[model samples]
Target chain A: MSILAVGTVAFDSIETPFGTAPRVLGGSASYLTLAARYFCPDVRLVGVVGRDFPDDYVQRFRDSGIDLRGLETDESGDTFHWKGRYHYDLNERDTLDTQLNVLVDFEPTLPEDYRSSQIVCLGNLDPAVQRHVLDQVDDPEYVLCDTMNYWIEHTPDSLRETLQRVDCLVINDSEARELANEPNLVQAADIIRDMGPETLIIKKGEHGALLFNGDTVFSAPAYPLEAIEDPTGAGDTFAGGLAGHLAQVGRYGADDLRRGIIYGSAMASFVVERFGPERLYHLNRELIVERARAFRELAAIPKLAPLQAA
Target chain B: MSILAVGTVAFDSIETPFGTAPRVLGGSASYLTLAARYFCPDVRLVGVVGRDFPDDYVQRFRDSGIDLRGLETDESGDTFHWKGRYHYDLNERDTLDTQLNVLVDFEPTLPEDYRSSQIVCLGNLDPAVQRHVLDQVDDPEYVLCDTMNYWIEHTPDSLRETLQRVDCLVINDSEARELANEPNLVQAADIIRDMGPETLIIKKGEHGALLFNGDTVFSAPAYPLEAIEDPTGAGDTFAGGLAGHLAQVGRYGADDLRRGIIYGSAMASFVVERFGPERLYHLNRELIVERARAFRELAAIPKLAPLQAA
Candidate 1:
């Protein structure tokens, strides 16, 4: 049950009310692969990094057990670098700069060994690039794709084309609304399902997340945090956790999808406790198990005595 | 166990994106009593209504199996009327008008039998009035009080005095922050707990609710609806449902509190389906049980297999 994460492996300069993280190791593929490697060992990453991409970061990925055969390095450009400032609430952010140097003209060609990955996680990128990665796949049993409002708005047709091939789509509340052109999330999920992926995960940051699969909808509550240091890679980490769980289980039943959402929610909760994705790298199996248990306790409803009126 | 609800019982003119419900039956006591009667048979209401109040609405409360012995009629003034307009999203609303006529100088003289009620639900009202009603209660085993930002800002001392006597305090997200002066809801709950009530429920309308009692927190998911006709009395309905559940169980253990939260959340879900408390009035026990089951399913996380790395 190998997971192939295809997207940018770049840098982020994040500024939050708490402090600043300068040029931290980031990008969707970076966080997704790191998170996916916990439950899933055979994680292959396909992305273009610039020549300026640190050797230490490459080593970090290798040390973390992520396959780098598909991690291409551009000879003449810097890595994709994004600079964003989070507001006081951290719910909204303002992108100050975006340097898509290497990613601008990037084209990924999955390695021969990576072509047969069971699960392909298409991270936020050009819709054409996502489909290009999918095109190289020999046989993908499950395809989980992530996209932002930028792609949904700028290249909707291409995005829809890519979405049609994916088994699941992971997007935030606002992105789902914008993409579906519907404010009501349930109806939005229904509309989106008609266009593409049967499964849709609407990530509602601190509120929680909702999984719409077939005729069922499963909700996972956000772990109540006392403070959020940074929220840079929470969404990617969530996707990673979910894909990893699914890959490990090697099935996508109703129960499996629900548990996967919980695991994803737990991972996303841990990532936001610190800046960037530092907290995720330090996590182990026991900690993850306990976090998942904590989530169960948080949303657990016990048996109740029958009402007197009843 | 008898439950007494004390608050404004009046009319509301609500304008949502869908349509308007002009001068419909509303107010905290109106919705609270209607919702609470579903769980606890001996539900008592203590509120003042104007002479202009329709007798049919009064009979409607009686027909719903609510005790109206403490419902006082004031001859000189009109009933409290609130006019509000909900935005397109139904999350934010603008208060168009507030006519605090009968509620301005309302003083309740609770009946002898109602004073001995085991559970007391103090809905959103002037802190002085909430405390006044509590003062007349003979021996309340469990006291659950709700408040708004206006009272927190306008009458801090009185609210704190009322809080000290109440066993549980239920308020929405913004009011909790305003009362505790903390932005983070978990921290806000802690600060508010120290101020008064040991148990606190922070209702996040669309997201869900958090129950903070003792050393535990129980999170409940909001029921995902295709449409929300109005959100006028959702919080009060939530409180009523919770108090009613607790009263029916006749105990307040950790498990009982958790289940109470689920029941309360289910009740709140139905109230918003239509304007004011109209939906609650037509609800039967079977529908309520099903809705609670739906909540359990909505937030249910299945028993996942151990991680592959483990």
Candidate 2:
């Protein structure tokens, strides 16, 4: 099963309390595709980069087994560049600058082969573009879409149209609350589910994430780290891991979703341990398995005999 | 095995976004003892109340199977009274009033029978009082102490001394950070564990809790609720349920502690569903078991074979 990821492929300058990193390889598609490669070998990336994009970085993605058939190089413009600074608590950060150079007039045109991808991950991008990609895919088994407050508030009609087509929608807690206009997350999930997608994942940064599928709900815990070097692209990475696992398993059962969420959480955990995608560069199957096992242990509760009714 | 709880027995006036309750039956010991009774039948309550306290409320404790031999009535002053107002988000609250009436001259004197209790729960109170209860109890198998930020700031010496004697300590995340002077929770847990208790549970309000025992860490998710009526005494109730479950199980294994935390979380969840202790009044073993099972479902993850080393 192949997983298609469509989003930004750009450069990021990140500053955290611990340290700072100059123009590093970043972007939604970059993180998502790299994380997805851990679970499934067939990960196809679709995004645009400028001439400024390094050849070594491009080689890194190719080395990780990500298909770049749909990736475009716009020699006429600069790549998307974002500068961000994190506060004392890494949960919140401010975007210092966002130069949408190549992304300004971006249009995603799925490659002929990518039209039959088993799973499609639409990263945080213009909802119109997400819908365009959706139009191209040939009945994807799973369509997982990620968005932010920007589209939800400014272009809700376009976002809602995208939501109606996707199988799952992933967003942070605040964005979930805003999108549904409900403060309570459970109720927010209910409202959002009613809007379109049957599955909704409300990510709560350090708190973890909640997966809502109709009447069923699953709670996943964040990997507790002593220090979080950088939190950029964690959410996108989580979405990729989740969709990738589902693609590999080729099922949508409750058990498979639960395992997917655990794997996704583990991938995101590894991403935040270092600046940008450096940690993911060193991530291996053994470390991922170990972390997933830790998650199992962390949440494991012994079965207690059913209590007699009082 | 028996469990002993020592803390305030007073009245609370609470205002939330949903509703308001005036001078209801509220206190640390009241909630702790009530929640504990659900797990351990022999729950000993030690606290001081004023003559103004209602006999009906006192009878409620007696009817709930809480041994009140250590409770005192200070006719000279009024009962401890707390008035609080919760913000829209229910996570933060403002203390409008704190009339430490009977609590001002309070001193916990455990009864002869309670001295032999297998577990002791020292609720949020002066560290000196918690230390006094520990001094009186006969070498109990477990001593679980709960504290707040006020004591951490005003009486560091006393709090430290109390921490040195307890087997386990339960406090919220902020207090843990402040007490350890470490902003990071994992680091904070490490620093606090070195101070005394081998086991530490850092409660993160709605985000849930973290259980740290040596190198082992267990994360518990707070039951997600669409409506929260009142949050008073949630932490104390959690402590009571946790210690009480341990007492009933008569063991301190990792499995037992994990079950205890889940039960504690469930009890706290039920408490916030309604104002004061009204919800707990109707809480039965069936409901507790059902909620615990729900928690199991909410966090349940399938075990996957370890991935091959890359």
Candidate 3:
């Protein structure tokens, strides 16, 4: 099975209460492709970077087994750069700057082979671009799309058009409320499902995520971490792991989706341990399994016997 | 086995986005005793109410199999009254008024029979009063105490003195942070555990709860409900259900604590479905079991197979 990811691949300067990272390798596709490669080797990344992109960073992606055939190089302009600062509570952050140099006139072009990708992941990007990518790919087995409040509020019509083609929508809790204009998550899920995606996952930073599929709802717990140096790219990494697991399993049964959520959660937990993609650089399958096992234990409860009347 | 609950027994005027309940029977002990009665038949309630308390409400406790021997009636003043207004989100509320008539000078005295109770649940109250009740009771099998931010800030010395005597402490997330003066929950749990109880449960309103015991941590998901009429007494109800379950099971094993958390979560979920204690009036054991099963299913994830190397 093959998975395709489309989003920014650029540089980020992040400042958190713990510390700061200057122009580290970041962007949605960077994190997504790296995390997806953990579960599915045949990952195709389609995004643009400027001449400012480092050679070693490019080599790192290649070494991670991500296919870069669809990646575009814009030598005339600088790479997209974003600067952000997080408060003491990492739950919220303020974007200091966003320079969309190469991304301003970006037009994603899928590789010939990527058209047959079984799973497509659209990271936080322009809804118009997300829909354009969907038009290029043939009917994917599963399309997982991620969006932020910016797109939902600015370009809702385009976002809705893109969402209609996605099988799953992954957004944080507040975004879900803003998108549906419903504060209640259950109601938001219903409204979003009616608009398009059959599967809706509402991510609640440290509280974990909720998976709503038709009549079934599953609550996934976030892995408890003692140290979270940086929370950059946690959501995109989550989406990547989820799409990657689904691609590897090649099925969307309830059990499979639950497992995928756990894998995604585990991956996100590791990503937040250090700044940018540093944690994933040294991550292994064994550590992922161990963390997933811990999650199972954290949520495990003894089977209840039938209630006996007193 | 017998479980003793000590707290307020008073009237509450609650207003939520959905509806309003004026001057309904509401208080920590009122809800705690009601919820605990589902699991433990011999629930001893120790609290003070004014002579204005209705005869039928007293009969209601008697009908629910909750011992009222330790409940005191003060003829000089009115019952403690609380008026609160919940925001649309239902997670935060504003205390519009607090008329602590009988509770202001309240002194809890456990009945002679209650001294031998196997489990003691100290609901949210003055820490000195909690310690007084603990002083009267013999060494019980398990002692669970709940507290709020007011006491943690105003009476730190007495609260610490009470904490050292309890086996377990349960409080909401914000209060945990405030009490421990640690923003991060993991760190806060460690700080609190070192100060007193070996086990700590931090409740996160609609987000569910986390149980920290020794080196173990268990995450319990809150039951997803479409509508929540009133969130008053949810925390106390959770404490009641947890203490009651532990007493009925008569064990403090890891498995038992996890089950107790789930039971507490379920009871709290039902409590919010209607204003005050109205929902619990008609709730049966079968419904509680069914809701608990739903929570288990919501959190159940299939065991992950070993991740295959990509």
Candidate 4:
């Protein structure tokens, strides 16, 4: 099983309360494929970069053993660049600028080899592009898709159309509320599953993520981090790790999905420790497993005994 | 083991997005002892009420087998009255009015029999009053204390003094931050424990509670509810249920604390289902147990197997 991740591969200028990272290696597909490579080796990347794309970063992807057959070099312009600033609490961020340079005109055409991938990760992108990628794929066993508030507001119909094609949809709490137009999360989950996606993950950042699968809701514990330098691609990293884990295990059963969310949380926890994807690029299996164990411990309790009435 | 709970027994007028419950039975001790009585029969209440205090409410406590020997009828004025309104999300509330009435000058006096009670729950009150109650207790084994932003701001010195005597502290996330003067909750727990209680439970309302016991932190799951009429006595009810569970088990170990938090959460979830303490007053052992089980399932993941390094 392999993952086909399609999204932006671009540069980000991020500013948080801690400091700033100017022109750092970032983007949805960059973080997704990089984090996914740790769990699944056959992770394929389909994204458009530009002439200004760093060679060292490209070498970094190859070093991680990511198949970049569909990584297009749109020499017409520089890569998609995003600038954002995070508040003091790090729970909210304000996008300062977005220059969708090459991303604006580039049409995604998946390489022939990537079409047969078993797992497909539709990173945060235009819903139409997401549909286009899905159209090219043969028959994905599991399709994990993500969308942001941008597409949810601007292109509701296209987003709803894409939602119907995916097995799982990963989004944050606000996006879930906004898309469903429901204040209560449990009700929102119900309304969202009606639109499509048998599985929905509402990421709450520090509050952890909620996985609404079928009629069951699993509350994955958030790793308590003391310092978060930059939260540039934590959500995408979370999706990547989840998709990668499912790919490696070759199963997406109830318990398997739960474990995948934990792995995703573990990956997200690591990515936020430093700027860009520095921590993701350095993590080993030992560290990942350890962090996952810590997460399990965070929410563990002995099986409860029924209390007798007084 | 019996619980000696010291707090208010007053009237509450609540306004929510759903509807209004005007001047209903409320106060910390009313909610606490009502929830606690399900777990332990030997519960004592120590609060002052006035002439206008309803006889039906007094009868309600009597029917539940709560020892009211420590409950004083001051008769100087009416009971403390609080008027508040909840936001649409039911997360934050603004205090519309607070009429201390007889409660302004009332002094709590624990009965001789109550002084020997095994457990003590100091509900949200004046820090000095909390300390005064502590002084009357005869070497209680485990003391659980709750406070709010009002005391944390107005009586920091008194609150700090009271903190040193309690075995566990139960407060919400924001109060914990304000009390510790630290934004990060994990770090806040460390700082708070240094000030007093060895165990700290930080309630996040809809997001659930976090129990920091020694080195282990347990993340308790929130029960999702479609409707929340009022959230006035939720924190007090939580503390009561926890203390009552600890008393019933005759233990306050790590697992005990973990289970106590679950039971506390179950009680809290029920209280908010109706106006004021209406739901809390009507809950039985079976309903409490069922909700606790639901909470467990919310955060339950299969005990994970260590994954092999890829």
Best by lDDT: 3
Q: What would the per-residue lDDT of candidate 3 be over residues B52-125, giving only the tens digit for each residue?
A: 99999899898888899999999999999999999988878999999999998898767788899888888899
* lDDT for position A195 in model 4: 96
lDDT of 1 by residue, B1-310 (tens): 8999999998999999989989999999988889888888899999998988998998899889899999999999899999999998889999999999989998788888777889999989998898889889888999999989899999999888989998999989889989988777889899999987989989999998999988888888988898888988988998888888888889988888888888888898898998878898799888888888888888888776666562
Model 4 vs. true fold: TM: 0.97
Better of 3 and 4 by TM-score: 3
Report the lDDT of model 1 for residue B240.
Answer: 87
Worst 10 residues of 4 chain A by lDDT: A300-309
How many pairs of residues collide in each model? 0, 0, 0, 0
| Model 3 lDDT per residue over A179-243, tens place | 99987888889999999999999999899999998688999999878888899999998988898
lDDT of 4 at A173: 88
Q: TM-score of each model's B chain? A: 0.98, 0.97, 0.98, 0.97
Scanning candidate 2 chain B in windows of ten residues, the lowest lDDT window is: B301-310
The residue-by-residue lDDT of candidate 2 on B1-310, one tens digit each, is 8888899898999999899999999988999999988887788889999989999999888888889999999999999999999997787999999999989988867778877878888889999999888899878889898989899999999999999998899999889989999878899999999989999999988888899986789999889987888998899889888887887778998888888999999999999989998877878898899998888888888887665322
lDDT of 1 at B207: 91
Model 1: TM-score for chain B? 0.98
